[model samples]
Target chain A: MIAKELFKGTIKTIVLKLLSDQGKMYGYEICQKVKELSDGELMLTEGALYPMLHKMESEGLLKIEKVNIGKRVRKYYKLTRTGKKEFGLKIEEFNNFIQTMKLILNPSINQSI
Target chain B: MGLSDEQVDYIENLLKENGLSYPPLLEDLLDHVCCAVESKMDDGTAFQVAIKEVLNAFGKDGIEKLQVQTLHLLNQKKQLMKRLSLLTLSVLLFTVTYIFAFPIDPPNSSPLKGNAKITAEFGMTFNKLKAQNQFHEGIDFKVPLGTPVYATGNGVVTEIQSKSTGYGHMIVIKHDDHFESLYAHLSEILIQEGEEIKAGQLIAKVGNSGASLSPHLHYEVKKQGKKINPRDYLTP
Candidate 1:
């Protein structure tokens, strides 16, 4: 199992990508989706996920819709236009970082030293 | 296998009892906890056991901590910055008054040999990379590695500490009963704890240590256990 510290920086990127792909997701749904995607290897705790969602909402990257189920209210988060643009920027940056790491970790594959 | 309205009310009441007062956070947590409990009930678990397991998964302080953490993340860069800037302004006013009332005297000496470049100032400033506003307690001098560090006052070395992070390799000196000076992020500590130190005496050497990214000395002065601006005391 991977250490949770390694996942800290990637949490925001993962949330942005998820919202971009899934359109709208509630807190629990995001957790379940992450778990499913990771094949139960990752769990996004409620403590970590809710604060980040609220922070993103305040940052104008995400908008919320409140739906009532019985007596309880569920908040669904969807990406804004800025959020979509941000996802593109972040994904590009992450891909570049991955490529750099790959070159360092596996230099034997490349012809150039 | 869904929770009844009464069961939902019980959970909501529990959240409120734990001091969760924010509306948006309250709503999100309420729904999330209910969903978790309902899913467990569907798998043949009792409602009591299910709710306990759900709250346990939230870790210690549970619902109460969620609201505090959410508010902190939202408030940090915006509202907190505004409040901190106001506080800094008031503190600056007090420091100016204190300086005018009684000037710092002969015990004061420059911590460095000659004119050194200051990389960061002592005051409230916003760090864009960290996305936070911080009150820098000390003045940071941008110097080369292994640069000699001096004691600013006649004092006894009271503490010498070495750590991997945060004020790593630091020394604290007690001066004139009410005043204390600190030097942090050192590559070498040349003085021993409890050793008597004279003004301008060599005590350490600057280096990139602790949470620092570059070689520099973080020097601070405190009066009666409160950190005051060292800029008020240092000579040119």
Candidate 2:
């Protein structure tokens, strides 16, 4: 299964969690970490990632800090208080949804799918 | 082989010439592209060839496509903001129009519009009891002493006076269209100068207080400081 198709509409929640756990991360670092952690199965595109980052930054859920990195400026994203709270709720909601889907898809003892 | 400042500038100039101008997005994309190209060159890839590989991996329109997507998102946000401010602007316009529209009363609602009664006629030749032959420029209303007299139209009270002689306890209201209405021989004046008076509002009480007058109201309508017969503009 292609990860991009499976990962639609969940970019903000994912980014929020990453920023919450990792503190501050620039765009390139985020792509490398996700690729490494997913074992190259989930690849983030610039088209998807940058737009989400800009939108969430506009929404006040994330804050941006620009720093001089070598020859150019690099922008880092970190979760705000609202972003951390949102990430926590989204994780709990996703866990409940997964449990409910599992109960329906793999019911036992004559509870047919 | 990390790309130098000049190489990064060259890449940025190339992308800018390709129509990517939003600053924050441009900076972020440029740094990422530069990092990718430099890392590939570290593995002995030729500089130009690595740059080509990174740009190709950026997809068909490359930086232009990403710029377009970011602009589209910001445009959606701008439209939402315009909608919110539009609601606020509409509410403000309604309130201003309402406060402005408050002062003007309806035209046919005047007291003299359809129900005027004249006790003494205007422009009457009164034989002089003194020297110059007097022409009565106003009409008289034969109401009882101290009866409330209504304003003929809407206006501001421009003048008021109480005297034992001519035009006693009088009120003069300045109306629109160069018109002024005077209510004289009043037993009591009920309005102040600079106070607004509505059509048919009680401004005085009728009484005999002026030169050779019975218990009545001496009413006058003037245009440009000249007294005109009130019957010319009023209906019975």
Chain A TM-scores of all predicted models: 0.92, 0.87
- Go through the candidates in order and give each one's C-alpha lDDT: 0.88, 0.79
lDDT of 2 by residue, B1-236 (tens): 66888898888887787677999998888888888888899998988898888888877786788888888887788899899899999999999997676543322233333343566688755534355556888887776786778887788898988888878778888886578888888887777899998887877777888664578778888877889887776645
Model 1 C-alpha lDDT per residue in residues B1-236, reported as the tens digit of each score: 66899999999998888788999898998999999999999999999999989888877786778888898998885786689899999999999998877555334688987899987788986654366999889889999999999999888998999998989999999886578999999999999999999999999999888878889999999988889888887878
The candidate that wins on DockQ is 1
Listed in order, each prediction's TM-score against the native is 0.54, 0.58
Query: Model 1: how far is B132 from its true place, Å?
Result: 68
Clash count, predicted structure 2: 0
**lDDT at A71 for candidate 2?**
67
Q: For each candidate, what's the DockQ? A: 0.54, 0.39
What CAPRI-style quality would you assign to candidate 2?
acceptable
Clashing pairs in 2: none
What is the lDDT, from 0 to 100, of the residue B80 in candidate 2? 91
